[model samples]
Target: MATLLLIEDDLMVRATLRQILERAGHVVIEADHGGEGLSKLEQQHIDLMITDIIMPEKEGIETIIEARRRHPQLPIMAISGGGRTRNMDFLEVARQAGADSTMAKPLRAQQLVDEIDQLLRA
Candidate 1:
């Protein structure tokens, strides 16, 4: 199982996602904001990252960019609950910044797992 970092500013989302990942056998480190996420990266052995695009302290794009600088080979999956429209814009920004993949908000746990696996293999 991959050591994953889940970065989301929403309390509910963070809790739910943490539960899902832990249940799936992933070693997960949870962070409620980008700043905390960055700190965790500096302190953990992360294999992949799943981050919410919109966040406090630092946005997902900024986080991804910084992460790329620190660990360019790290795979990142950026997600956002931007309704529908313009959501792609956020995803695109994350991709350009550093994320290897992106997913829409309300992420299906199965899909998240699939993407994480795919990124790890890639």
Candidate 2:
């Protein structure tokens, strides 16, 4: 099983994602914001990262960029429910920032698991 870092500000959403990932056999490390997520990434061995786009302390796009710079080979999956801005999609921005994959919320558990599995394989 792979160790995953899950960065989400919403407590309920974080709990739900943790449950889903754990059930899928991944060891999940939870962080309420991107800064904490990056701290965890430095402290532990993380195979993949799943981060929400909007967060306090640090947003996902900036986090993705920094994380990518620090760990270029780390797989990142960004999730967002913020929808579109005047011109750009949050998920698309995430990809541009350095996320390996992106998903919109509310996320489907099986699909999430499948995507993580595929990322781990890659």
lDDT of each: 0.87, 0.93
Q: State the weakest 10-residue window (summed lDDT) of model 2.
A: 82-91
For each candidate, C-alpha RMSD in Å? 1.7, 1.8
lDDT of 2: 0.93
Candidate 2 regions exceeding 4 Å error are 83-88
Top TM-score hit: 2
Model 2, C-alpha of 79: deviation from truth (Å): 0.2
C-alpha lDDT of residue 87 in model 1: 56
lDDT of model 2, residue 63: 94
Please write out the lDDT profile of model 2 over residues 6-114, one tens digit for every residue.
9999999999999999999989999999999999999999999999998888999999999999999999999998844533388898999999999888899999999
How far is 95's C-alpha from truth in model 1 (Å)? Answer: 0.9
TM-score of each: 0.92, 0.95
lDDT of 1 by residue, 71-105 (tens): 98888889988733645688888888888888887
